[model samples]
Target: MVVNNGIANDARVIKTAAALRRAGAEVTVLGIATAGGPREETTAGGVRYVRLPVFPRRGATAAYLRFALARRAAHLVRDPRRWQRTLPSLRWYQRAFTRELRALDPDIVHAHDIHLLDTVARTWPPHRCPFVIYDAHEYVADLAVAGRRTRREVESWAAKERDRISDADAVITVSPEIATRLAAEHHLPRRPTVVLNAPVRFDGPADPGAPAGPVRSLRAEVGVSASTPLAVYGGALSTARGLGTVIEALPLVPDLHLAIVAVPYPHPMSQELRELATSLGVADRTHLIEPVAAHEVPAFLASADIGVSAILGTAASYDMAMPNKLFEFLHAGLRIVTS
Candidate 1:
């Protein structure tokens, strides 16, 4: 399996890997290395994860230095080709992934998103290529981009997916709506399999020494008494999530406390939400918690009074999708309040 970002916080990827492992298949997930994380590690379940670094180095510091130098060189050269000059670091990672893929020589290749769809398709000739699975986590073609991507770039992604999607032996997506759209748009032979972004089922209490550690209740973690009314939202902090709406509405329900367990905390959006809460005189009732481990989420959120998915109609993708946090909340036994 291949993904563009670090795999630590991706619940979908983690769950998929675990399921495949339980089915007696060997899985190796190739993902981009994040700062201060290991380049390679094996999970407790024995699935191997290889994180391709942007530079050839064992230490994160050295890798960052080399990447910074490459970016500096790209600026100095000021090449007319925009991609070549602006994305030297990305190119390095791509080259590294390609090299790693060749070394693995697996029987099946799973491309996690459109970013690596073309790369995996072109890795080998059609006659001897592995059975490829393209997993679309979102409706990439019509995904909402907020100032981070140009229209041309978004179109290029759509084109890339359209071009290489036929090469995939099977396709998987997070929602039924996305699966139907993919088949219609790409003219696939069959609708892609719908795999809702659900949390892993728990048959019993997790072992104490588990990777996630003992389940820590949200109220305890946030230093709130058991009687405190807590509404929690867990996932990426973005405008698309309509978090600002939640913060703005806090004043209406003065007794209710909202906790946002956001990935990559101290994010710009989280800061903005905090400021908004303060302006509304509900700052004390708002809590910002760093994201918990993927396996630990349901347990961690079990004690919260409510789970909120205030997703805004910011884009077509957001409107047609089912957010995974909803399922996590269900598994945790929390009542849901969604938009």
Candidate 2:
């Protein structure tokens, strides 16, 4: 299995690996290592992780020049301008990923996204190509709009994704909505399988007379008294996630305090959010906590009275998303107020 992001914090990837392992399959995840993380490690479920080093995006000036010159040279023969800008960064990673993946010589290659499918397709031998599973974690083409990628870049990805899907042996998507759209949009041969990002369910009863779970004094940690009602929002602190709306609503509900337990990625809006809270005169009522491990999410969420998921419908992907945080809140038995 291959994924672009670091495996340490990817709940879906971790859960998928664990499930595969439990089903008597040997799982090895290839991913990009987080800074200060080991290049290789084994998880508790016996899943092996192999991380490949990525090259610095800014320092590849010579490579970028070469790519530009190559594009000009190829332009005369065939149009290469469509992927010119993305090639500079994508080229190095593609080469490195291809090298590492080829060495594994696996029976199956499960690529997590359309971006990695190019490398997988390029590396696998044509005559003896392994069964490839294209796992579409989201409506990837729409992700360009969500992430604010350029039009050219978005078009490039859309074309590549459409081409890659046709070559894939099978496809898997996170939701039925996404599956239906992807098939129609890409003109897929068959509808992709819907694999909901549901949390693991334990069937057996808890240990009799076992020690109680660890206590979390959220009010104490945030320097608030027990009388204050806490509204918790956990997940990525991005603008599209609609965290700012929650901050804006604080003044209207003066008695409610918000605790944001989030992982800031791509953009950390914490400082901006703090400023917003301060401007609204709710700074004291707002609390920002670092994200916790997936195993601890339920306990952390249980410490609050209400769970908030006010995602803005800025893009099609966000509008269609059934985020795992929603399920986490439900499983934690917290009252949900979602957009």
Model 2 lDDT per residue over 231-334, tens place: 99987666778888999999999899998887744236778998999999999999987665555567667768899999887666777777778888988888
**Whole-model Cα lDDT of every candidate shown, in order:** 0.78, 0.73
Model 1 residue 273 distance off true place after TM-score fit, in angstroms: 2.1
Best by lDDT: 1
* lDDT tens readout by residue for model 1, 1-339: 998887776778888887787679999998887654556755546578877664555455766777778867755643333543444554665676777887889899988887777677667777878899999988878777764664445555676677678989999998999999999999999999998889766443223346444356688778889888999999876787888888898888978999899887666686788789899999999999877667778888988999999987766778778877988999889999999
For model 2, the stretches where C-alpha displacement exceeds 4 angstroms are 34-42, 57-81, 84-87, 144-148, 202-220, 223-227, 264-267
Model 1 global lDDT (CA atoms, 0 to 1): 0.78
Q: Which candidate number has the best TM-score?
A: 1
Q: Which pairs clash in the backbone of model 1?
A: none
